[model samples]
Target: AADRVYLLAHGKVEKVGEGPYGAETVLEVLADGAYFGDQALVDGDATWSYTARAATACTVLVLTRQDVLNLAERAGSLRGHLDALASIPEQRTNKYGEAAIELSAGHVGEAVVPHTFVDYELSPREYELSVAQTVLKVHSRVADLY
Candidate 1:
């Protein structure tokens, strides 16, 4: 999954893969702010189909396909984040003022184009598996496991 999608926090990582007939290729070298696995995540696949290695000492933040699904089912926290995104108003502006203008005319044979309204994209996608990660911010009994 590392190759499929990760956000680099520091240092660097490389994506290596094999082509037809066992030919190896360096697919990409990614640094900070680079991300992949979006295609797989959007398309509903959890299996990582590539190999990832550290080009240097590195740190990364990852979101696996299953974790994305869990975030959807357990989206109470994400709602606030999304709601904040929704409150912003979108408009079209132009030279005079507005980009979209209304027009109406009467004639022997006049063709009218009706306006269709579209809504914002804020729906959750369905997934088959589940995933989660926990960052321990305390020195407690669970520290023993580490």
Candidate 2:
């Protein structure tokens, strides 16, 4: 039930979840620069399926859901990046975050193999650079006084 995304800046973190038999299981061990609660970026109502605990003394950076939306509005690149990330289908990735391949093995008869393709982004994330300019004006009388 995390309302914000957490980025582990230093130390280690353990993602724990409950097993079917009411046992606590360690789902993943996250290291520095790892991201947790990232589903909040795409789904506003998303909740953490697992709990994160610090394995060691850790420094975490947190960003609320509204903070991401506000930043996305200001930066087109970030919006596009988030959109691309959200567009990835869950079925395409495995639990280890690797590409999943569908295969049929030891079939009695001929089986139809599932066809899958890797989705690639045609346009990668790009940033828009902004510049500011100012003009200083002075009167002739002011210059004479100086």
Candidate 3:
């Protein structure tokens, strides 16, 4: 029944204690699939003294102490799913932003139109092209010119 605990997603450990610091075992390292505060649940204690950080991109399923006990008592499927989730990395949800294109009067005269893959002139050897699609997704903020 502590306030905080930590889990390990990879095989690494970090220790924090009193060498030159205030003087206390502030932290203890754990391995992948290790539990930190099981004694509090078994003995009805209330206090925690450790925190955890992701060693790599990990899928952390956080639950309150009560929820942890409930899930631990549930069917084995929940535990299996937790194990599976622990083995995977967190995915990035990319957020696209609005972009503008600026060209000189003689560059984008009035007769030419640009597509998603339009190539823009540069130097004699370096030219850039657009690879982004023109279609906007649902609720996407799009700004562009013809």
Top TM-score prediction, candidate number: 2
RMSD of each: 22.3, 23.2, 20.1
Q: Write the per-residue lDDT of candidate 1 for residues 56-115, one digit (tens) a residue.
A: 998888876577656756887565654554465645654333345444545446457467
Ranking by lDDT: 2, 1, 3
Candidate 2 C-alpha error for residue 92, in Å: 6.8
lDDT of 3: 0.48
Point to the candidate with the largest lDDT.
Answer: 2
Clashes of 1: 1
- The residue ranges of model 3 lying beyond 4 angstroms of the native Cα positions read 1-6, 11-15, 19-27, 51-57, 71-146
The estimated TM-scores of all candidates read 0.41, 0.65, 0.31
lDDT of 3 by residue, 1-146 (tens): 46334454455454444433556553656556765554343334655444444444554434455675577568587667555645554333323222433322333435443433333446555438777458643322213432
Q: Residue 98's C-alpha lDDT in candidate 3?
A: 26
lDDT per residue as tens, model 2, 1-146: 56799999999999999865779999889998888998899877887888899999999999998999999999999999999978876666765566887765443665666887876778975748698678856545447788
lDDT, residue 45, model 2: 80
